[model samples]
Each structure stands twice: as C-alpha cells, then as structure tokens.
Target: MSTTSTPDNLELATTAREMADQAPAGSLEKAVAGSVAITCATTRTYQEAIDVLGGIQPVEVRRPAIEFLERLAVAAR
Candidate 1:
C-alpha cells in the first residue's frame, strides 16, 4: 500500500512530533500528554472543517432534487 499524508494527517504527525520534543524526561506523563495532544489536534482539525461547511449549501443543493431522484431510479435498474 502507498503511504500519503493529507493535511489533517500531517497536522496529527506534526503535533505528535512537538509533543515528543516537550515531553518530560523519564516520566509517564510524557506518554499520556503526547497521546492527548495528538488526539486533540486531530479532533480539532475535523471539527473546524465540519463547522465551516455546516452552514454552506452544497453544490448539489443548487440543482433540483428531482434530477437526482431520476438518476438514482435509472441506476437502480
């Protein structure tokens, strides 16, 4: 499988790297904090993108719903 990093994936990786950099020496807190940072960064990116799009109309909404219904009917045959 090919490995590629999307923007959100890149952000998560970057957050993990920063956490590694700041982790305390020989402490369990370091691992816990690093995990929390990665989770928070990934969640924040997903939430922010969702929030931005939640208010906008999709391009498909500009078209009549009947058009999609008709297409679906044909595809189902």
Candidate 2:
C-alpha cells in the first residue's frame, strides 16, 4: 500500500503531534494522543487504535481525549 502526504493529512498529522506534545507528561491524554497520532499516520481508524490500547475508561477521566479523538476520526475520513 502507498500513502500520499496530502496537505489535509499532513495538517492532521501535525495537529495530532502537537496534541501529544502538549499533553502532560505520562498522562493518559498523552498516551491516547500518541496512539491516535500513530493511527492517523496509518490506514487504521481511531476507534480501532483506541480499542487496541484499551478504550478510555471511566469516561470522565478521558472525556476530553475521547471528544478530541472523535473529531480527529471524523476529520481523518
């Protein structure tokens, strides 16, 4: 399979990287953002990536990340 770095995709990738970088060190948000960044770089969906990393638990703790991932997933398409 081949991947082209379209402007939109590149921006998304950069956004994901920034999100991961801005997140607190060793925080769940950081981990999730990092995982999502990897997923965004590939052909996989955010849900698939999140699930594999163990879906955000308690909901409240990861509410922000969840919302962000949802937006990213939509944008990814």
The best candidate by lDDT is: 2
* Clashing pairs counted in every model: 0, 0
TM-score of 2: 0.50
RMSD to true structure for each model, in Å:
18.5, 6.1
- Runs with alpha carbons beyond 4 Å of true place in candidate 1: 1-7, 33-77
* Model 2 per-residue lDDT tens digits across residues 1-77: 11232224445556788889998998877876776566556634444444543444546445555556567646555
- Tens digits of per-residue lDDT, candidate 1, 1-77, equal 11121234345435444655686875544444344344435454434423333333433332322232223223323
CA lDDT of each candidate? 0.39, 0.58
Candidate 1: 10-residue stretch with minimal lDDT: 64-73
- TM-scores, all models, native as reference: 0.29, 0.50
